[model samples]
Target: MTDQRWAGVRQRVEAAGAGPGSGEVFGAWGHKWVVEEPLTRGELAELEAQTGVRLPEEYRAFLLHVGAGGAGPAYGLFPVRRVRGRWRWEGDGADLADLSRLDQPFPDQGPPRKLLDDLLAQRPEEEDFDEIEDFDDAIEAWDERWEAVMFTPERTSGAIVISHLGCAQREWLIISGSHRGTVWSDCRVDDADLVPLLDDDAVPVRFDRWYTDWLEGAERTALSAP
Candidate 1:
């Protein structure tokens, strides 16, 4: 999509908030921008080289054509260089995905889902034997597996950090895996976490579409206001 479409959204977003220094959040959904700028072709290339993975084509275009790091959901699109800081979790600070592993295929979700479901169903409500330690061991094992898949970088290989949603939430764009170009939300606090951004049709939403939707929604809200 043309960068011009984003310009109107930026205008509306700016009008909603006094300014970046005003500390006023914009949009009904609490979106705002920070660190507004555009990335050069050379910079984009260097980022790809450093990360060892190509960004999704549209996202790459956005960085080069649209502004680099502003006018997006949450605190806005993190400057590519600044992504490393927000890439990790708040509690343990584990990197979302290792730079070296960015090119690796993301693991299949089906296997892990089955493992978790089966283990959860088999969990004992009451220990028949006197071995309480056995129950503890089983619980720990399950937790370790769950954490690895839920919060670690390795589980989400081939995805790059997109934006921070605040309060321990984040957004990611798949770049190297089978479901590449799709946007996924990492809702760390939610029970069903790491879901794809799906539209009403249930098709996975890509970077451009997800962003456009946000902009359009903000515009509609702007127009409908009293």
Candidate 2:
């Protein structure tokens, strides 16, 4: 997708009270970006079926109505982050970057790792959809339903794992349990906790202007930490 498409969406999001990406709460590392689509039940099922990841209850609830733009949860807005400060990341999924390696690492992984795996993939074919070229395109198409990560024990040399979403960290979450018994839960990014990450005087930048400023020097010091 062209940057033009995202540019329009970004403006619409900011106009709709979305904040630029900040390290605030569920904000991405640097610039804040709005989630392209608000997740729904039908969408959720599609993602689960495709990735074989049973999303966490909290996340599923959040997706159903929370944090989405316009007075709902899944409130798509990720806060804009600052240069340098002390921040604490807690939870089992916090440093789980290496976990994606536990996956089968292919497009159409055959089945999960249980007897149910065969049963799960046994459903008859439905209407087909064309796959996109990459993540950005998938987002542009508002195709978040296909967003899932799948891995297996024999393939990953361990257990089965999955994630309902994928991000830049090379991170993959296990939405469901693995045959080897790995399970995951997502931690909420609390505002009371995130506010302290910034100095008392951190200022907001125009959504259009923040990302460049972030790339120039604002994020340098922040990225220094793990």
Candidate 3:
């Protein structure tokens, strides 16, 4: 099933690449391609083994049949090899996944909004400020707990970042748990919750559906546009 779907997607992409205005479509629109050769079955297996997790079917199909990286939404897809290092947001002191935990089941429930509000409300009142050092100490303790809750992977457990969509937007592929194979967008910095990408029918879109939808649109737009 995955093979057939992927083949159709590739056909559409290749047909579009040959169409008029393809350059404009790729350059200006959401679609682009680094167009590397696909990975072999052995390579795919090695990646799963190293991560201690099974690759979701469609995503595994993507890495094996599509380009091994390069050319995807926003900044393009992340190569399997690139996932091992600290993520892009790690330097910002944001909580994020370490390579060791990528295979673990993503937490079933995300931290609730009310819980976050409560934590923020816990900030020491100004009247509680006694000595300068005491206030500083109190603040630091609060910051630690806040950061931990904010960064904990419970909400996004069993997922790995697949693309950095710029502006703190990102795409993650869930690898473990019930949501495995589903793709989600991380837009929390914008005060938005992580959202699942859905197809036209409102079904949760997996990697292949998401990728092909983008490809099909790019083709049609390029061929039809003036």
What are the Cα lDDT values of the candidates? Answer: 0.64, 0.31, 0.67
TM-score of each candidate structure, all chains considered together: 0.71, 0.27, 0.73
TM-score of 1: 0.71
Off by over 4 Å in 3: 23-32, 82-97, 119-147, 200-202
lDDT of 1 by residue, 154-186 (tens): 677887677776666778777788888898888
Model 1 worst lDDT run, 10 consecutive residues: 85-94
> Which is superior by TM-score, 1 or 2?
1
List residue ranges in candidate 2 displaced over 4 A: 1-31, 67-170, 178-226
Q: In angstroms, how far off is 67's CA in candidate 1?
A: 1.9
Error of 1 at 18 (Å): 5.6
lDDT of 1: 0.64
CA shift of 105, model 2, Å:
15
TM-score of candidate 3 versus the correct structure, residues matched by position: 0.73
Residue-level lDDT of model 3, residues 27-67, one tens digit each, is 33433544556778877777766667777888878777766
Question: In angstroms, what RMSD does candidate 3 have relative to the true structure?
Answer: 5.7
